[model samples]
Target: MPLDEDLLPEARKSYRYQWYVVAICMLAYVFSFVDRQILSLMIEPIKRDLHLSDTQFSLLNGLAFSLLYSVMGLPIAILADKRSRPLIISIGVAFWSLATAASGLAKNFVHLFLARIGVGVGEAALSPAAYSMFSDMFPKSKLGRAYGIYSLGSFIGGAAAFIIGGYVINLLKSVDAVTLPLLGEVRAWQLTFLIVGLPGIVLALLVFFTVRDPRRRGLRRDADGGVQKVALRHVIGFLWRHRRTFAAHYLGFSLYALVLLGMMAWTPAFYIRAFSLTSSEAGYLLGVVVLVANGSGVLFGGWLVDRLARRGHTDAAMRAGVIGALGMTVPVVAFTQVGQLWLSLALLAVAMFFASFPMPASTAAMQVLSPNQMRAQVSAIFLLISNLIGLALGTTLVALVTDRVFGDPKMVGSSLSIVYGLASVLTVLLLWRGCRHFRRSVAAERAVGEPAAQPEGVS
Candidate 1:
C-alpha cells in the first residue's frame, strides 16, 4: 500500500532516526567484515608459520568459520528480535574483536581454530538484528536502496581490510628484517590480525551509543493482542505456505553466494599464482576493486530500487536483479577463463559491480515478503542456508576436487572457476522463478490485510 501523504511530517522526523540506525549498523558491519576478512589476508603467513597444507588452509578459510557461524547465527538472530539489538550487537563486537586479537597468540591449528570459531560466534549477531531494524526504519519503496547502502559496509570494510592489512603486514615484515632484540618483530600475519581486531573495540562503543530500538508494531495481531511471536513451528508453517517463493529466492541467493564466496575465498591466491602479484599487491588491487566497483554498485542499485518502487511497481526493483544475474554471469565466466592479468582484473571488476547490484533488491524482497514479527527468524534462516551451504561448501568443494583430480595447487584456480560457472546457471534459473512469483507474493500479502507500518528507510 502507498504511504499517506498526510503522514509526511511524522515520517521526516523518523527518517533522521533511521539514518542514525543505519550509520551505527554500517559501522558494526564494517567491523564484522574487517575481523572476518583479516584471516584471508593472513593466510599465506599463517601457513608459513605453522607449516600447514592447502587443504587445511581451505578448512580454516571455509569450514571452521562457516560451520560455527552458520549453526549459531539463527538462534542468536532470534535472540536479537526478542532482546535489545544494540546491546546484543555491542557484546558481539567485543567477543569477535577479542577473539580476532587472540588469533595472534595461537601456536597451533587447534588454538587458531578455536579463535576463528569465536570470531564466528560473535559476528553472528549482525545480519538478523540489523535486517530487522532496517526493515522497521525504511518503507518498502525505499527498502531496496536502504539495504544496498547498508550492504556497502561489506565492500568498504572488506576493501579496507585488504589494503590496510596488506600495508601493515608489509611494515611488520620490514621490522622483522631489521631485527630489534628487546621488542621482537611480529610476523606479518600476526600483525595483520592485531591491527584488524583492535578497531572493533571502538566500533562496539559507537554501536551502543548510537542505535535505538524503533518501537515496531506488526501488520497483524494474534489472540494475545500483540504481534505474533514467531516460533520454530511458525517458521515451518510459513515455509509450507510460501515454499515456492522461499525456494526460488533461496536457490537464487545460494547460487549467487556460491559463486561470489568461492571467488572471494581464492581470488587472493589466484592473483598470486596467475598474476605473480605479491600478497601486498594483490590485497591493495583487490581492495581498490571492492571499493570502487562493489561500493558504487551497492549504492546505485539501492537508489534505483527506491526510485523504481515509488512508481507503483514494487517488483520492478526485483526485476533488475534478474538482469544482474545474467549480466554478472557473462563477465564472471569470461574473467575466470582469461589468462592475462590486466584483462582478468578488468573483467572481474565488471563482474563484481553487476554481481553486487542485486543485493539491495534481493534483501528488500525478503523484507517485504516477511511479516514484521517473523522477519528476524526468517532472516536467520536465510543466513543459515546461505552461509552453511553456499559459503562453507563453495570454496572447500573446489579445493578438495582440485586436490584430488589434478594433484596440483595450480589446478585449484581453474577448479574455482568451474564451480562458479556451474553456479551461474542456477542463479539465472532461480532468479527467473523469483521474478515470476514476485507479483503474486505482493498480492497475497495485501489480501491478508496491510498494516499501518511506520515509514522508515533501510540503513
Candidate 2:
C-alpha cells in the first residue's frame, strides 16, 4: 500500500500541509478535553455541594457523556463523510463550547449531566472527520506520521485539562474573599467550570474561519445537489462481511479504553489519598508526563509504523499496538504496587508512553482496512462500542466494586488498579489476534484491485 517512488516528492510536500491540519485539530482537541475533564478536578467541591457519592461522580464523568456521545457518533460521522467536514467540525465545536459554558449554570446532578451529554454530542464529530481528513490529505505511505501528530492532541489536551483544572480550582478557592457582583463568592468548582469552558468559544471561531472544506473528488451531484453514491446500508454491509476483523479491533480498543479511561478518571483521587498531593500538584505533574512521555510515544509509534510500511511490513501498525499493550501493563502494575510518589509518577509516565503508542496505529489500521466511504461509520461504530462499554461501564463498575465491596478509600484505588491490569492483558490478547488476520485481509484487498485507501488531504 505504499505510494509510488515517482510520487514521493509530492508526498513529502503534502506532508507539510498534513502537519497544519494536525496543529489545528490539536487545538480543537485541547479545548474538548479542558471542557470534558475539568469537572474531575472539582469533583470534591461538586460532590459536597450536591451531596453525591463516588458512584454519582463516576456517572457524571462516564455514562452521562458516553450515552449520547456514543449513540450520536454514527449519524454524525455519516453526515461528515457526505457533507462538508470543515463545516461539520465547526458546528460541532460551537455546540460543545456552548454546552461547556452551560455547565457552569448547572444547579444539580441532573442539570450537569444534561450539559455533559451536550458536550459529548458536540465532540463526537471530531474523530471521524479528522481521521477521514488525514486519510485524504496524506499519501498512503505517510498516513502513520500524519495520524501520529493528530493523536498527540489527545494527550496534550488531556494533560492540559488536568493541569488547568487544578490551577483554576485552586485560584478560585484562594480568591473566595474577593466577592463579585452578580456571582458572589463563586465556589471553586463553579468558577473552574466557567473559566475552562470560555476558551472553547475562541477555538470554535478559529475553526470556522481557518479550515477550508475539502471536496470529494469523484462524486457527482444529483438533481437535489447531493452526492449520489454514499449509501448507509452499503457501509453497514461491508462491516458485516468483515465482522471478525472489526470484532478483534473493537475488543482490543475497548479493553484499552476500559483501563485508560478508568485510570484517568480516578488517578487524581488516587493521588489525593495515596500520595497526599494537592489537586493542583497532581494536575501539574500529570500534565508534564502526558505532554512529554505520551506525546513522544504517539509521534514515535507513527514514525516506526511508517518506516515499517515502507519496508513492506503492512502489519507493522497492529504489531505496534500489541507491543504497546504489553509494555503498558508493566507500568500499570508498578504504579499500583509502588508507594513512592516519584517512582509512581515516573512509572505513570512510562505507562502513558506505552499506552499512547497504539492510538494512531490502531485508528489508522481501522481506516486503511475499511473501504473509503465507510471510514466514518466504521469509526463511529467502534467509538460507540468502545465508549458505551468502556467509558460507561469501566470506571463505574470499578467504583462500585471498590466502595461497595471493599468499603475503604485506600482500597478503592488499588482495586481499580487490579481492574486496569486485567483490561490491559485483554487488550494485548485481542490485538495479537487482530494482527494475525490483518495481513491476509490486506493482501486480499489489494489483489482484488480495490484502490488502497489513500491519506486524505495530505497536500
Candidate 3:
C-alpha cells in the first residue's frame, strides 16, 4: 500500500527547523574532521619526534584510523538505525574528542597509534546517523543542497585544522615545552593535539541538548505506531538487487576519495618540503584556498544538481558528479609537476575546487537510492569501502611511491601527482559507467514504488 501522507513524519517539522538540524550536524562533522585532519598538519614534526618513516606516519594518518573506523561503522550504524541517533552522535563526539586529546599524551609511536585508533572508533558513529537523519528531514528534491551544506564540515574542518594547527605550532615554536598539572612538559606537536581536541567536547554537549531525533520515514510501523526493525540480510539483498548502481557508486567515490585523501594528507608536506615554506605559511595559503575554492565548489555542485533535478533530470546528482570528476583530472596532475610555488598553489586551488564538486552530489545520490530503513547501514557500507580504499591507500600509496619507487621523501609532490593522476582517470571512468545504472535505479523506484521493491518489517 502507498504510504498515506499523514503517516509520514516529515510533515510536522518546519523546513527552517530541518535546516537548523543540518547546521548542527555540519558542526559535528566539523569537529570530527578537525580531530582527524589536525594530525596532517603536524606530520613532519611528529615524524621527526618519533623517528618514523613516511610509511609509519601514513599508518598513523590512514590505516590506524581507517581500520577501526571502517570496521566499527556497520554495527554502530545498525545501532543508529534502531536507536536514538542524536544520543549516538553526542557520545561519539565526546569520545573522539577525548581520544584526540589523549593523542597529545602519547609517549611513543605505539601509544599514538592506539590513540588514533580510539579516534577512529569514536568518529565511526557520526556520518551514518547524520545521513539518515538528513534523509528524513529533507524532501528528496532538496537533498542535494542539504547534503552539500552538511559536507561543508569537511572543508571547514580541514581548513580550520590547517589554519589553527599552523598558528598553534608557530606560537609554540618559541616555547620549548608546555607543562600541564599532571603531565610534565610536552612538545609543541603534542600540545597542538591537546588544544584541538578539547573544544569538541563542548560541541558534543550542544548536539545532545539541541538536536532531537526526528522520526524515521518510509518504514513500516506497527499498530502502536512504532517502527519495525529491519533484518540485516534483507538490507544486503536490496543492495545485491541493485548491485550495478552500488558497484559503480562505491567504486567511483572510492577512487575520487583516493585522490581527495591523498592530496589532503600530503599537500601540506609538499609545500613544506618542496618549497621550504614554514608550516604556518603552507597552512594559511592552503587553508584559504580550500575554504574559498573547495567550499564554493561543493555548494555550487549541490545547487547545480538540485536545479537540474527540478528541471526533470532524475539522474542529475550523478551527472553532476561526472562533470566534477572530469574537471578535476587535469589540474590535479598539473599542480604536482609545476616547479614554481605560486604556480603550484594556483593549480592546487583549481584542483581543490573541482575535487570537492562531486562529494555532495554523490552523497545525495546514495540517500535517494536507499530505503529509509537501510539508509544508515548503506551509508556505513559506502563509508567503509571509500575509507578503506581512500584513507587506507591514499596516503600509503604516495608514501610507497616516494620511499621505494622514487627513493626520495622530498619527491612527495611527484608521488602525489602520480597517484592522483591515475586515480582521477579511474574516477571519471567509474562515475561515467555508474550514471546509466543510477538512472535505471531511479526509474525502477518511481515505477514500482520504492517501498514495494523490498519486504517491510523483516526483522
Most TM-score-accurate candidate: 3
What's the TM-score of every candidate structure? 0.92, 0.91, 0.93
Pairs that collide, model 1: 137-456, 137-457, 138-456, 138-457, 145-302
lDDT of 3 by residue, 124-170 (tens): 99999998898877676678888899888889989998899889988
Clashes of 3: 0
Query: What overall lDDT goes with each candidate model?
Result: 0.77, 0.79, 0.86
Which 10 residues in a row give candidate 2 its minimum summed lDDT? 450-459
Model 1 residue 87 CA deviation in Å: 1.3
Off by over 4 Å in 3: 1-13, 220-228, 451-459
lDDT of 1 by residue, 215-248 (tens): 7755468878766667778877876687888788
Distance from true location, Cα of 136 in model 2, Å = 0.7
Model 3 TM-score is 0.93
lDDT of the structure predicted as candidate 1: 0.77
Ranking by lDDT: 3, 2, 1
